[model samples]
Target: MARPVPVNLALRDRRIDIFFAVVFSAFTVTSIISDLLPTVGVDFSQPSDNFFVQSNYWYAHDADPLFMNPPDWMRIITGLSAFVYMPFYIVLVYALLAARNWIQLPSVIYATMISSLTGIVVFGVEFFGEPEFRTQNAVKFLLFNLPYVLVPLVLLVRMRKPLPFTRRF
Candidate 1:
């Protein structure tokens, strides 16, 4: 039989946890809001010219499109995020703010699933799609998307063990 390792109720580093929570909270909130707004017309592909959409489109519509001309699958996944993942992120933000230990396992699972899906999409587009669909700058693409991948991965590692079912802060 496997022995259960004890988890500390107190956060190992309060500052880091708070920082990640704030960043992700902001990102998820913005994503949800941007996606929810009505586009300029009936075109689901044509997003409104709001700050968030414009900023995202600027990079997406570049010479070697990163997000501007995403495949149908990407669009569908993003749409799902607006409804499903956005709410999940909201819950995660609350959990993080409360320093709820119960969030550890779910956080790890979320990280793994999201990161893996992102990897599959990015790599799949790069390899299977038309050459023009590939990102113009590999390094820039990775850098831009690194946080989404890294944050969850780090959180997964940090929360590998079970945490106490109590608030830390």
Candidate 2:
């Protein structure tokens, strides 16, 4: 059996890679901070509340028929993201910035799981839930959620192939 070839991060365009890493890192950090604020007693229900939560609430209001209020399930999911996934994203940010070869597998796994689950739940609520809870604007809803789906997908594709290895004599 032949050994699988590995992808070389060094061979890729450094500037572009670094740019993406920086952008994703910022996104992850902002998300973590936004989610963390609520845990520290920041009220997110009001539009005048924390900027991150306020922005997110408006986005959800514009997209989801549920409006400014999230359902219990959604709240639970948000809690999970806040308490668990946010920290994981911090690690991901570091790994991405460093171009660590070991991150490829875990990144793919995390991206797939998070994106797929989010998609399923979001779309399910939009389509199958009570009429009042269905999304008013599918396009806006999808657009609002696109980053979560697309970023991970792009990462998965870029990191699908493993990094090359040099055999020790």
Candidate 3:
């Protein structure tokens, strides 16, 4: 038995997947440092210090409110991102880079999960939460968080066919 040859991240043949890999890798790092660490009381969410969220995500969290002082459901969502999505993201990055067919099904589930969580649940709260909970700034929310919804959908289309990496796009 022979192992499949895995391409490096910079390979041009899988341009879109390479792009996805880069974007997802960024999200993974940000999620771990900004989102996950804050959830664990790491104190990095404070804007005066942290560079990643200093002028961007911190403001969005303050504007949206659910991110900082989340309700029970939001807490569960955060936990899911931390414990579930985080590991999946790491593996997904590897699978994308390695062109592993096994990632297709998991990517499907992740696409559905993330798109719903971001596009519906998070937006629902931002748009319809009580006066105190609704987002103070809609533009920032969209700019900062839209990718969580859009990228997964793109990944879905990318993974639609069998052995997605084997096909040139």
Task: State model 1's lDDT.
Answer: 0.63
* Candidate 1 local lDDT, 1-169, one digit each (tens): 9977554444454666777778778768755654443222123234456666665655455433635655566666566557766787888877876777778777877887778876677656754667777877767677666676787787776677555333232
Off by over 4 Å in 2: 1-8, 11-16, 33-46, 49-53, 164-169
The local distance difference test score of model 2 is: 0.64
Model 3 C-alpha RMSD to native: 4.2
TM-score of model 2 vs. true structure: 0.72
- For candidate 2, lDDT tens digit of each residue in 1-169? 9977554445244454565566576666755755455444455555765677776566656886553456666666666667766677777666755666677687778777767767677677787888878888889987766776677777677666656111100
Return the candidate ranking by lDDT, descending. 3, 2, 1
Clashing pairs in model 3? none
Models, CA RMSD each: 4.7, 5.0, 4.2
Q: lDDT (0-100) at residue 12 of candidate 2?
A: 42
Per-residue lDDT of 14-99 in model 3, one digit per residue for the tens? 88988988988887876776566545644433565656546435654556666766667776777778778888889999998888
lDDT of each: 0.63, 0.64, 0.76
- Top candidate (lDDT): 3
Q: Compare the candidates by TM-score and give the number of the best one.
A: 3
Which scores greater on TM-score, model 1 or model 2? 1
